[model samples]
Target chain A: MTQPAISPALPADWRDFFALTKPRVMSLVIFTGLCGLLAAPGSLHPVLAFTAILCIAVGAGGAAALNQWWEADLDAGMKRTAQRPLPAGRMDRESARDFGFGLSGAAVAIMGLAIGWLPAAILALSIFYYSWIYTVWLKPRTPQNIVIGGGAGAFPPLIGWVAVTGDITLMPVLLFLIIFMWTPPHFWALALFVKTDYAKVGIPMMPVVAGEKSTRRQILAYTVLLVPLSVVPWFIGGTGMIYGVSALVLGGVFIVLSTEVGLRSSVPDDAMKPEKRLFAFSILYLFILFAMLVADRFATIYGWQA
Target chain B: MIDDPRTHDLELFRARQKSRNRVLGSILGALAVLFFAISIVKISNQSHKKAEAAAAMAGQH
Candidate 1:
């Protein structure tokens, strides 16, 4: 067998560097950040809120770029990521690394100056958590990687809350927990479908290391935990009954999907159906939950706080 | 390494340069759109608040 080349031709184009940032993922992060800002009780200048969201987006993008840079080798081996900018020889490793670092640093500094030091500090911590702790240390080491690394994705809403309030509270923490618990089920569903891609790349995702049965069981367990957790914001009065009802309905559907994924074995070719359904519903679940939070806030303004 | 014939393929080099420029242009263009959208929203919000205040004063009279 011929030896595979390690580093290929470098893409001199700047867009290749941009591709490393994962703009699609950044959009969700920015949206959650905006929701956090809008739902907070405190007031913020419009410009300042915009600045905060921008910084969150940039910081998320930067962390993503760093992740791609670090995982370029693994990416090359995985069919799903084989065509990524770094792995496809569309960008050089050193350049991607530098771009990630520059964006992380600049985002933190701009946030500190334009917003406040607290939010800026949180932004910096999130970047470090994602780029260094999650991507570098945890991801390749253990199957529990996504569990602990999920905190990085969960931080945006908390950062958005802090951007307005300049402090942490139980409400923001609840919001963080909602996303924290939501991450595993959402990602693992995708992982179930993509296990082969991960295994081919030598990455030890839960499905690869523990087998499909265990991964399915873990997904169900997380979904069970997530249902109760999603309803907690309403119980604690951070949100109202509109959110409570939405959470209950959405969470119920999520658990049903998870159970189906767990119960079915030797699924027909199309019967991995539950996994795809769960993945699609998971996105809608989070969106509806956050949208309810915003809607409930407006309801309170209109004398429907309950 | 510097004298490689592949590096001196002028047409390929020009094509790469053109693609790079186009990508950069699109990114800057998107950023411009985002900036203007945010600016317009802020301006409209301020105007709405002003109108609300004026309406409240008229009602008080």
Candidate 2:
């Protein structure tokens, strides 16, 4: 077999493969998936739940690896991602590609065999959506890339719900919608701060393609949508008054920050205070919303009415 | 297809490392699954015994 000559310039090892998995992102995905599994009404075998979480982690890792592999050239140009495994020449591109495919295939197969078909199917879709559809196609083509592509991240809770109940319900779909609406504000804030890096790399992120004013306007729009969507689960009776109050309070704060970001005009070249504030608060918003979901789940489980 | 000796040697090194890592990963994965299974069985058994004792006491009463 005639293998291509290994690039002597880039000597990579196993650690590079691990780094390509984007462990930080995988942590959030796994946490939300676990929360969904735990919150669902149906019972799942403990071992099965563990397997489901593991599969979600593996699938997320695989997708992240493939994203790194596909975006290696662009990543090399971006200061934020210049140190990634592929761009840093710590791993051969082909190796990363193979590892991603292997991990993704194993994760989907294990999910289907051990858990259920619906969750496995959703997992498979998420992997492909991120790896190919989002990374390969949408990323380079449009500024609304993150908007459509956010579905990949939003699937975890739904996958978790399906893992437990073997069906998709309105509640999980609402959970999906909440994240979907939240993604634009969260990511666009980061994009606004890193617009120059994206512009230099020729990646058409919202801030780069649409300009900061338009991006901020879009962020406000999404935040407005998100605030209402956040309270939907409570209104629908999937969650309790506690989550309702949390959603309203958190969503109110999110709107204030987003409005500030929209109204601000004199931000310094190197200083992105509004963007930074939005990004920091966005993490808190998602965490509190999901935490409320889990709290409500426990309340119901313990027979606490309200 | 210029066969550089250094490149060939590097390829050989990578192939060896890949195989070693695969073997190690598989062993660790299998061991983890076995350990979890054993612990689950033990816990379930203990719970079952407790339930059985409670039922017996109830019958006596």
Candidate 3:
């Protein structure tokens, strides 16, 4: 149990407020959401398209701010999170809460009025799901927090598709599932190395509660599911050869990397080469997969491939 | 509130936050006005085009 610190003089700067948004995470969310919008069959007015992407980004940032606010005390215990505005005592808790709610409310309202209500509703749900469901309800209680909480992150692409097409479809649902299944392996890899941080904070991450063997097995299992799920869009003729080939190669590499992580045992922190490699490659895998999806759409539109 | 010695820092922080909120509120207010104007222009443009097309059809008839 980490007690809150008291420091009176250090006021939070603008950068601290920006950091509350988790800009790095927001980047991936924005990219995937943009890809989903591009890959959809129909088109939207340029202004409306921009509005949708902005809403997704702002909503993501708001959720991140709320997550940090809720975890400020727990974060004070972890080395990686102690420097955050709230934990560092540079900003008040009420400030973060009010800022987060303000951004989230504005984003949802703009999305609903400018684009469509469906996407706006999903965006609102994503923020609530991350801030309340994952952070408050699940993280402290269960080792399966990442699994259930994965739905929160997966909403971006689904919302993007709805923004473009005005409804849900098999394609958007598949995109949602792809991210959903991908989250466990992605986060578990990070949890493997940061197991101590989670344990110290009393957060029931898989590695802390279930032991390393179970965590590794679960990681590999998710990777196995994700590999097939990733290839389904291509198999269903939703994407062309370029996307199909990229998914196959990326999925194969993901499996190989995950296998290495699972098979290795008791590697030292300084020598955690395989786990580090898997974690790095997983991010690249998603980026390239989504990029290729958009590239494949352009290829079709340009008559570059049949 | 700032006169309370025990809570001076807290009151100062609250005042800063309120000022920031006021700035943000003004920006949002401006943006809402802009969006409303754009919507009105778009709607009028669409109506104008519809009237022109209707006139063209009636002339042919």
Candidate 4:
């Protein structure tokens, strides 16, 4: 815990604090949550809907802050994470911890009061899952951290659905599963290219614990499972052709890219193109998939070709 | 309280944190008030609609 090397007087700017929120990751959380709310059968008050998304964002930020707080020591050793506010010694650990708790507590309280309790309850659980279960327990100990911990990221849409419907249903659950299955491959793609970082930091990422060959095989396997699972919503009439077709096409590309990643033996610096492409496309694939869901719903409402 | 020299810096940190918390607390308080006002307006609007419907029924009678 003693980072004796960092100068005590180094000033922390507001951006350093903002960096703790993991804004890029929160964007996907917000998008998915919004899609869930919009795709639901009923309408919500716009104010309440905004509040729900805000809560999700704040909860995610808090979880990320806590994750950094706990892993500050581990992060300092890794080049990828060394510049994080905590690891960089731009912010004090106590402040980071307190900030995490404050944001999480406020988000949950506002959610329970302004919206419904179920979503708030799930939001709390999601934060706990990420900070405690994944960051604290699984990440240091096991190679399968993201596989099980992906539930933390999967909860936003489910929470958003519950916020609208005030209960669990099959559709939101399927959306959850879609993201859940998608996580391993998406993360493993990044992990494959960044294996050395994990190895250096002594984190048991799949690529570090298992060989790259095994990691690539698992990535392909998850992508294969994810493709069919993503289409389940359309098959069950939960979504329309817009989402169905988009998912099928996007999934085809995902399979092709992942297959290439799996089959390749040599990953030269310049030739790691497949992994890079997969990582980049995975983000787009999810964003487009969710966007199509919302578009499909609107199309159905207006009696347009969906 | 025993004045331990080692905790002097921590005491200042806590004081700073307390003031920051107070500011955040005030913002949350304002938000709670806004939500309360919204709820009240919604309830009043519903009741006003009910009263108008009742008056219309009475006139028909």
Candidate 5:
């Protein structure tokens, strides 16, 4: 007797479902949100604080899922994103959609009930912004997509601050702006090398639409704008010298890298060394900058050395 | 029977389903604990606020 045929595709497992959440990107969201919560003046009950961060993380995950669901085709076209669960055919679209909506709804509901409706509302808006505004609309249509999409990522810190303070303030708004301005240089650096994959998918990334020269110039411009903005909280007396000095030092290295990237002429078959360095350093820069914000706050509380 | 393709497929499917169920159960359990803790915190905070207000009123009177 002939052996029976076995299905080549395995059923989607929990790990595949988890990958739909884009946990790597979600980590950045959680870190910035946590820093915002920690840096804010007032204290929330530990439970409420945990809930607020949970909501932010889950909501970001939900948005990421919806993005994959919507962009599965586009993702499949790109070498970089082709391995994602939906793109790789590890998961079905309906499961992804249901999971996204379910996670988003639960996160908002828990946030509203446990924390305030205000932060919950912001969380909901952020999910919508990332899923619909960025992923569905701007990304396909415009070269400046990530610039506006920055707002979606920027909401975490603002939401984190508002969760504790229960209102918007200059400080929180500055925190939002810091992330907003930071997004482009960080993303465009990555885009500089990955432009080919974006071009394959017709996504109109900055580098694809504007070319490497313009993209590198814009990266340097955004980095220059970001350094001053990161230092603004200290200038306004919102943070102490710890953050201000760190901003200057970190921003100094950031400028050096950006300048190197911006000034260099691309060689044919080049490795994109400067752009890659800037890209990696940009992530580390933001993580350290936000950590300093929290550290400065604690120093104020405990009278530690700045 | 052990080498049968259909039986191997069935085993893998069952394993995937089992893993998904376990994850779902863990999430539900964590959520239950989270909600309960939120309720307790909110109740205590509300009562403390009420007591503070009542004491202030008494002092004014």
Candidate 6:
């Protein structure tokens, strides 16, 4: 008689646990959080600043893990997410959930004890925003999920700023708004291309629910709003002309590219090059824009106002 | 018998568990060091503030 083959019940790899944190997404969170710390009015001890950014990153990771835990079924349905640890059956949902809660609680406690209460409170709220508000409530139900969901990513900068200044200010709020507004156009461009995956999984992403035409137009609309909003920091003397000019140049390019995506009709099987271009440039745009904010601060210290 | 696949699988699992434990151990150590540093900084900052307040009071007198 032939022996029946059995697969070894192996434990999940350490890398799979790491992957649950969505490290790629965490990079942007860390960058914005650090920029917020850098751009704030007062100074923080370097160790404390590192701790603040670390808390933000860990909190975001916890939230991402929770998101994956809740969406495992939906993730398994979509090609883009089918390979995730939970979706792929490499990690158990219970482990993911435990890891999420542990990281989140540790991060919040450290933030409060090491930095201050306000930033810690905001850190906890951002985790709640992403895990409960965006993931559990909004995403499955609303086509406008990304709009409201953008708030989760916006808090890092605000938290970082508060860690330094220990008080809320207009500039950090503007930083928050820039991310909030930039999110819709940035996400929808990717949605325009991979909308089929979302549709298959019933996620109600704008492109999947609103159709490409409406999605494109809205992407352009948000870009138009974002350009002016980004330039506001300079207008109000919150930032120098370095950031101002960079924002203008970057926003101009964003508008031109978004206009292309906004104005054109995509063919059923086209490469979606414009949407792809906008998506790539949008990432570059925010990185450069925030970098300019820091650069402007550096320049002002060296006596270069212009 | 010396080359059984189940033994290899068990060995691999043990190795992964060991690696994860090491990482967790390292993180806990780092957290202890971090908390110590934070406590020191907070104490120093409080003392600095108290000294400034005392100076201001003396100036007022």
Number of the top-ranking candidate, with DockQ as the measure = 5
Note the residue pairs that clash in candidate 3: none
The estimated TM-scores of all candidates read 0.83, 0.85, 0.86, 0.85, 0.95, 0.95
Off by over 4 Å in 1: A1-11, A267-271, B1-61
Candidate 4 C-alpha error for residue A204, in Å: 0.6
Cα-based lDDT at residue A129, candidate 3 = 95
- Against the true structure, what is every candidate's RMSD? 6.8, 5.8, 5.8, 6.3, 2.6, 3.2
Q: Candidate 3 residues A130-208, lDDT tens each? A: 9999999998999999999999989998999899999998999999999999999999999988889989989999998
True interface contacts reproduced by each model, as a fraction?
0.17, 0.03, 0.00, 0.00, 0.76, 0.24
Decoy 5 TM-score against native: 0.95
lDDT per residue (tens digit) for residues A1-306 in model 4: 532343234334556767999999999999999999999888777777888998999999999999999999989988989999988877999889998998999899989987879999999999999999999999889999989888899999899989999999999999999999999999999987788888887889998889888998999999999999999999999888998999999999999999998888754564678898999999999999999999999999999974
What's each prediction's clash count?
0, 1, 0, 0, 0, 0
What lDDT score is found at residue B51 in candidate 5?
A: 100
DockQ, ranked from best to worst: 5, 6, 3, 1, 2, 4
Query: What global local distance difference test value does model 5 have?
Result: 0.92
- Give model 1's docking category: incorrect
**Per-residue lDDT of A116-201 in model 6, one digit per residue for the tens?**
99999999999999999999999999999999999998999999999999999899999999999999999999999898899998
Worst 10 residues of 2 chain B by lDDT: B34-43
Q: Which ten contiguous residues of candidate 5 chain A have the minimum total lDDT?
A: A2-11
* lDDT tens readout by residue for model 2, A110-180: 88977778899999999999999999999899999999888899989889988999988899999999999
Model 1 Cα lDDT, one tens digit per residue, A224-271? 999999898888888888889999999999999999887765444545
Rank the models by TM-score, top first: 5, 6, 3, 4, 2, 1
Report the lDDT tens digits of candidate 5 across residue range A158-216: 99999999988899999999999999999998988878888887889988788888888
Name the lDDT value of residue A103 in candidate 5. 93
* Model 4 chain B weakest lDDT span, ten residues long: B1-10
Q: What is candidate 4's TM-score against the reference?
A: 0.85
